[model samples]
Target: MYSPNFYSFVDRAKSDENGFIEFHNAYVSSKMTNSDLYFVLNRYGLDEEQKDFHIKISPSKTIQPKDKQVGELLEQRLSFEKNIPKAITLNDNIKPNIKVNAIEYIPQEYNHNSFNSPSEHHLIESITLQAHYVLKDSHKKNIQGDEQSLLKESIQRHKHKTKWGYIVFDRDEDIEQTLKQLNKTQPLIYSKRFKELENIKGEIVNIPFKEEWENKQIRFFAYLWRANRDVGWNYEYTIEKLRMELNHLTESAYAIFAKEFIRIPQLREEYQKTIKQISNEILAIVDEEKDKSKKFELAKQYSKEAYLLRNQVLNDIRDKSSEFARALAKSEKPILPSFESLIARKMQQNNFMGKFENLSLEQKTKVYRDIIDSSKNTRKSVNNKMIYYKVFGRTFAIATIAYVSYDIYYSDDRLKTAREHTNIIGFGLLGSSVGMAMAVDTCDINPICYAGFALLGSLVGSSVGNLINNATDTILKKYGYE
Candidate 1:
């Protein structure tokens, strides 16, 4: 799913004398997973139709494209071949009589998770399905009048015609335009809207069994659509929230660390100013570099320098003032849950030294390194949990709210339900932002503290909204208003 986006084309060429359509400088990229390529190919009929062809994709020495092609195509072929680790051969003899329904064409990955359900990761991006419409028999056949052979032929050919259609349920805004285009060709139908396809007499044949199955499939698809939207919304929300909180935490910690720990009053003002100057220099380097990889490397280098400067400053402060050293040492206690296992090891080694002056320079260095490592580990763990909650937890909550709203507000009064849901969510978000702003200064290096405060504020805001809604309902009932 994280594969780099690149443009590739299948060039058509005639088969050689050996009945082989040999491609030059062409291969499936190793960067592309089998499921990835399968998803792309499945849309164009990988499992639905029969084909009399064999595909052989084997590794070979570097082969050039057509001699005259000088610009982009030549470059692309070279890039493609360079990235390809291995290639696979596909040979199939599909039966003409075999018919695969739209819902049956599931990729290999789905098998591991569920029969037809997509993985959470795939759902986060988009849910693309090759959907089909039920094109019913236009003319009803007289079964009693037809002979046995005629009946068989009519059954095979007259019941329905398979019309292959392409559909993409993209999570992007482009989906609106895509739906519009699809609507021009065939009216987009919702499963909940059409209870029975047979109601459209003359077009739909009365087949109760098939109709029931199709209804189930339709409901499943509708569920997938709802899940897809919920996942996308939660993913974006959590990522934005994480980024904002991280930035706030980093700035706060840096300000506190620089002003309190790094700066030495005894040193010259100019000298003190240069102690934390590398952070600014690293930002400048990042801004100057256009290439992402190079920028990352430069930032990495500066981070190492920053760490050494921190250690040097801590040592200097320790040697000058034991009082300041003790204070700084106390701050290194297990501030985060991630530090427990790490600090436990150190505690056993040093017998949990009470006095900072008693510990050697090596001990101090180890403690500082442990705290840094724990902070990094905490950040990673928190980010993953944040993603999980954003995808599943928030989605569940929203779905529940929506369902409750739907139940409370009858179909005739859906506008009220929509308004109430919007108001509640809006209030919660507004409260969250205000809470974050108020608590950012109090937040320490641990990100969990800030997240907790934000969650508390959101809960309070939602509760207030619910109470207001109940009060309004009571007033309305008291006045005999609908």
Candidate 2:
């Protein structure tokens, strides 16, 4: 009832040595859940013929002229999306028999992100590493310094890819020609007359940027032509050269470029044709419909078809960042001078990343440091202002004692001299002790007990101090010396 589409590959060396090929990297379309699809494949995967449960291979490439090495191994991302026989058992570890098919052979080019999807950090790291290998020989020939100098120079050598998307090289016009050719080709595809569609076809389309050679043009739109893993554009030097420059321009041409510049646009044009054809069909149906009652139902059916078709197209186009663009987005210029003014030479060329993604490593560090410092200052200010329960209780006690002493002995005219001076000195001591003994380490005080004690102490101290003051005043007033 169900079949799966897989992105598959073969490693001949491992197969020959191990005597069995595995489909570990096999994945279905992004639409299907892996758990559901793989469970079915693991148990029920069968050959195209359905006689034996096996993978029927199509010959992707026979010989690589550039590599000058010929073998059974075809560098490819094979897609499996056909009927398969039901499983004999439900075991997950069951292996299917190998079935092979041969076709016109094509060469494989290396795509960096063709394998396990890597994070931005990992992607940059991989690009820098590969660049190092490319530049190693040149570096050795040019540099002959001390070990420390060599290490530091090596650090400079492996800088991140260029930030600017466009660079002006002596051969830029050559690339521009190719770019223009790529842009103009697609509109022509969509404008094909019926006679032209039957008579003429475009060349096999592949992303020129992902090729091992410098960017080149292709004629036909190759649907789902994913590059193999291993190589990137042999323009590491070009990227490195452009990166080290202080004045590389951000490209607006890529935006200005016409519809056929990328495969996504071509797919869009194809869908546009499908939409127009469906609309024309709906009109024809309207003309033929004699029964007026059936018109509404027919209109609803046509609208439903249009909605489904458009949504499916959008799903195919959505969130699919240009894998080719990612491959072309390599640049390595390490020296970041003043980030405040680095907006012209900014590292990120697109809006693909978060706020931090656009910023350089230097800018991020500076922003975070400022945040930490501000936080520290805020915390310190809060801690200083916070009056802990113990501190508040002690201060209140000191204030009450001072208040009582002033009201009684200090204010009394008939009070003995010793009592007056001693009470003044005691008040001073109590105030000093209150300031010194109170801890204000944080904005928070301890438990409810401390808070309760502080509140109760304030109330009781005020009452007792007032009572003492009243009694002392009465005694002083009744005395003859008062």
Candidate 3:
């Protein structure tokens, strides 16, 4: 007779709170279905124990007769005949209590074209059960009595709760034929088992089970299953999470640097203060150190940290500078001169040797040279041709207008002659507009340079046109048309 306590234990094991049933089902499927249990038992010297246990655990009359027959059929299908010659023989010690009312093993049906070509054989290779089982007193005693009790306990407690338990069978001509016969009679049961086994391997092993197996087998299985599951899930999750966090950090860094760009001089001053603090700390450490090796190590550490901080600050500055450039490109604002350039220009405006200045001539000259070099590099980096063409177009347009105005002022016949010249100048202006439009598409230049050059070109062209008109009028008055 089956023990009620054993059934209760199995119920608890299979309960939703603890997924013991799922785990045990997975264990049995992996070992029995794959028939790797024999090899595992042999390798770990549990062959005799496994054989004894297998006989004892065989489904009795207490289990449904149909269930027992199904279990037997699954076992037969999974058994390694070459390795275990006695696999087919029923052990006389353990009498089969359950009557075999009817036996059926069906393969799940699949659409051939869904996975492969219609001509290709689409074989249903495995069946799985989602089941719950209770631990027998003997099983619990075996687990507790084992030398590796901790490993046993961990496996029993943690294995197979969520998304656990699967059984797979190797395909054979006989098995396929049997499945075909079964499928004709009961399609629902066969389809259910097929769906249960599909893409289920590691999850089944994670479900907890009755700790009746040897300690070594339990440990090996538990460790292998956990490692496989972690590889599939945990490790990838960790790396992906870290990558996402790093991307977020990069965005935060940009935001901080953007704030610094708007208040650059203030940020530069703050950076100087940080550098001073670092230097002071290094000096204090150097003074306190007695041992040469220790001092060298400490100094090196300080220097490395300081260098890293400086590099971070520099990168922040670069990011902010790029942001500023982008903003200026869009705004077409007057390029505010660089801090050093502005200071130098102010000094030059006051005269290098001015009585009002505190800075020495040598200091002023050095500052001026640095500003000049910076300005030169900045200009070199800009697209000069684009700037030049933009300025030239605007200047030519203004010159066309001034020339027409001159024709009005100096014409012998006032309205008629002026109108005719105005028409000529209007054509020139239209040509200039087309040239400027073409120039705009030629390159991506700094917007500040574009605006500056355009304004400068117009002023210069207007001055030249005025000078030309005055000279023409003076010469014309000396001759005739005036």
Candidate 4:
């Protein structure tokens, strides 16, 4: 379970004239303190320099009244966390007691080490911030006041404002109950979550993001949120949707980066490793799953992911090989990387697939089988190519010899005595070479069959060549040369 660095939610933040940061009702990750959060924010390009930040959240203030009784009841029922609106704020100044240090952000797990350039780094940071903030809002409990009428009023107002969307519950029973309470047409969904379901309390949140963000962006963040939390998402239903989105994003990112910037070697290696690790994890799950349909779907998903990863890796290798060649050419003591060396580097990529020793016997067997099959296919391809090359070379050589022999034998009457014999031998050799090439491709690997075909072709060619030579000699003799 490789987890990426989780980001804290800064609902709103601003900078003061004195060059200090103000964080308002922000949610920090459990592992990170305020000082640590500050450092991370700066590192990710979201800091005091940005001047102001805002993320739209739920329970529109205008919809709720200022009734003191309702407010008091809400405060009593909800704790400090539940009472506060989804709004976030930052204080103008850091607390005097809290010491801020310049600490580096080291990821606890490898999520995406491919982001090496400043621009790529910024993109990942932005994605993390967006996903976390949106998720925070989606998980918050809807503020149902003490009175039933107030709750009805709020629901009515919200319902009129936005389209009704599906709700996802953490437990299976919860899903069934919710589905019965609402429309049966609403689908149940599930996905692999990092956290345990028993430890954390789950709430029914309204369609959190669709109303606020663009459809494409909404779906993107939705996938991210579903992936991290321990909830059942209908994998079969969303497999195509999610897989296509991933492909689109991966290809789009690769295209933009390849065109706009030079790749960093370390980043490319990490990216390649990350994809492999993810694919291996998926394969492990597929092996564990007993349900046939789910297993098949998972297999398909894995294949698609692996295919894309392979293509990206091959493209990277090709570009790097060209680059390495160019760089070596420019150097005073230049030496090009060999084909074997390139292949060794490729094989080294599997090192990043994480621990494979822990796999069950069945999984290990399956993996080894796949490797063997792949090797066999590669060998077959190489053998076929070599066969073609050899056949072409032999045919070319034999044809050249036959043509040259005929030209020389006919160029002067001095060799006319042996012209017929030479022609027969040369044509027989050419025919035999062609026959051998044809037999190799069409026949079973039998030496006797090849020899029989070669002999038959040689006999036919000799007869034709001898006839032509004799006819020419007769004509020349009649013309008085003989």
Candidate 5:
């Protein structure tokens, strides 16, 4: 298991020289070092590129804050998406850092508004927030003496405070418990973790990603936190706060990442043989390319082509994901990701479901990659497209080939007149070409598979020849022209 721990707490951060809001009192537990939780959350955090802002404006423009354009600037910086946040900092990699500029609301007199905005307490210009990527650093435990000072400072700063507005994330109670139970049983292969995963996999196999399973997910993470309780987070500080924050944004991709990321370690032993074999094949091919300059040039061309294709694929993925996220955020009713279509693709690709008992950790990893990388077009759209070519293009070619092959091979056979041959060829058996259609459809198998088309053509030609022979016999007797 990857077994990375996660911990989150809200607190006031220090302002740097540039005066960006930096949270120091995350109060992360001792065992779960700042690095693990930091990297995991940052790995699955709301990416800057996916962050869309919903700005709140007040009508009382008269009593504005000192920084008039600051609010506008904040919106400009935060609202407009940037590239995906980087996971590692240069040289020093203790904790993954996000470079975001966040504004802590120092609220003053609140202006009230009722139209358009759901927020009743109008955000008076007194509170201005700056925007930057959030950065994570070393653990800063909130000391006992600091609590009172911090509270006093908060009240003093926002003396005329208006309303409490913070993003609250919640997950269901049952789900949290289930995750806890599974985390407890994670050590053994036949333990409850496997069972719970199966349950979740089944439950989320359809549309309307249900609430019950989401709760399970929450419980899973919560318990995963507790799994390292002795070394990481203890029950005293985190569990209650975790339980309180029940309504988390469920649609995000973090949980899926966490679940799949853990399975990576599980695949190491199972795939050793395959990896070694692939390495040997690669070495052999490279060794065969003895001409140094020629090999270098050929390799350079392939590398350049691969790089171009990768860029195009990544760009398309980002565009689609961004579009889907925006639409889902605006959706009236939201749910977890069912990912059924992705799961079906994985199952079909690896044939994972064919023999559940035979599945090893490596095969499981392959299946997981299939689902996770579906957006990246990991599998080709071959079979789904083959039928179309068969119907439209190959079917016509079947009959034409049959005529030419039969004429070339069997010109000595009894066919007296050109009219008779034409008449015979006119009645082509379109339906009898299914075998040829299937063969051409599976051209990936081998070129010989296309010989089915030849057989189809020959059958057609033979039928035409018989019709011509019989028809000529009838016409000669009836019209005396033959």
Candidate 6:
């Protein structure tokens, strides 16, 4: 129901300067008047006090000569007047003083704010101007005997011209009509206007009148007006077209985000449920296994399944996280860096050994430290090997103790004191310890470290026995007690 600044054509007036008469309204005169004496009036006299002027000029009372005698006399007089054409001057400087009698005409009641109301009826005002002139020839004579010159006699003349009209209505109605008309006339106006706006890059020029509007509607009214003034009414239609296009684009973006971006949370929930189910199944398998070695194998299988599932989830999140972030970025929210790049930078820090060109030196250092800390609690090869050896040694000790106890309790005394018995007991304990130590040190000095430690205890026992026998033989030989 809002209205824009309305414009209407008011009264137009003319003024004579030298011999020429100029017609113009008050607004045009104010803008164009410099050296010329211009009659000022509003094109739409909405601001002025409306007045009615009554000025009527009648034709001269002179009869044309029809007889030969009268025509011959008139020709002689016209010949004489033509010879002295410069002798008389026709002065058109007489300003027509128009006196508007307010009593004769009552002013119409006009509502300046009528467009603000919700009523459908609006007023239309119009004004018209007419001029009457008198022209004369110099060949006529009076009743007494005075010569009637063209400059002295008067005859009626009529010449008139009209200016373009103006129309005013509610801003919305005006815009609607303007759009409809422009569409009917030419559709390219919209595209042309948009193209022009696009061409205006860099710093924006502020339009003062547009800022005066309270809302977008009024602002659009001002915008349309300015555009109309600049590029003509042809471009006013572009505003509506542009607005429609903007709405469509916004809806499309929203639809895409709704269908794709909003599904991520649901997908993540489903994935979490799947992961939990897989983890439970794996734990069940580990729990059901009875054999120790088989239990270890089942745990390994669970670990592999868990790792694969986790990796799949991570990859899914990493890839879709970027797509979701992109969708959000394109929405009403502000722009930011991509999630994929952020994750990539995080992973690079963990796995990269060489210099990462993409990362800053400071970032690389921070990430490297973070990765080390995250993996700090993981077991090393030496710790794993030590654990394995301890468990294996305990099992072997139990077996050996059972065997030795049975032999000592049930076997004969001769068997119990046998050298093989002592060697077997000693070598078993020594060999188990050395074997465990060798397994722990197998990574130290390549092949020699592994071989040396693996045979150290067995070699020591054999060498000692040989030395003892050699000494005994040497002493026997020296005493000749072979």
Best by TM-score: 1
For 294-318, candidate 4 gives per-residue lDDT tens digits of 6555654554455455445434443
CA lDDT, every model vs. true structure: 0.36, 0.31, 0.35, 0.36, 0.31, 0.33
lDDT of residue 72 for candidate 4: 20
lDDT of 6 by residue, 1-482 (tens): 00011122333444357434333222212222221111222322211111111011111112222322232212111111231222111212232122111111111221212211132112212111221222222223333344333222221110101011112223355655554564555542342322232222111122122222222232111121112321222122223222223212111112222223233343344344445555666666666777655665565455545555544543454344323332322242233334334335555746755445565544443443332222222225423443443344334333444555566667666442333345543443344235435554343323333334434544554355445556665887899965
Question: Cα-based RMSD of the predictions, in order?
Answer: 22.3, 32.5, 31.8, 28.9, 31.6, 46.2
How would you encode candidate 2's per-residue C-alpha lDDT over 1-482 as one tens digit per residue? 11234323221213436344443433324432322122123344332222112322221222233322321233443343553332233322332111111111122222212311222221111221111112233345655667456644333322211111112223334544443453464532232310111221112112223222223222221111111112112233333222222011111111111111232332333434444454566556744666544654454455445444444443343323232211111111122124332322232332324565566544543333232222112123323323342244334433444454455555545355334433333333333223222322321233233223333333444344445556666898899545
Which ranges in model 5 have alpha carbons more than 4 Å from their true place? 1-431, 434-461
Pick by lDDT: 1 or 3, better one:
1
- Which regions of candidate 3 fall more than 4 Å away from where they truly are? 1-262, 320-322, 325-482
Error of 2 at 210 (Å): 4.9
Model 1: per-residue lDDT, tens digit, 196-215? 23222211222222312211
Backbone clashes in model 1, listed as residue pairs: none
Model 2 off-target regions past 4 Å? 1-210, 219-274, 277-296, 300-482
What lDDT tens digits, residue by residue, belong to model 3 across residues 1-482? 12232221121122256322222331122122232221111322222323333334333222334543455323222222353324323332332222111112211222212311132122212322222223333445555454345444333332222223222223222433444554565642343433232233322332222223211111111121111111111111222222223212111112222222223332333344444455565556654877655655565455445445544443443343333333333354244434544555646765665431466644443343333322222223233433443444334433443554576678878765553443333333333323333335532345444333333433444344455556767887899867
Error of 3 at 181 (Å): 99
Comparing 2 and 6 by lDDT, which wins? 6
In TM-score terms, candidate 6 sits at: 0.19
lDDT of 5: 0.31
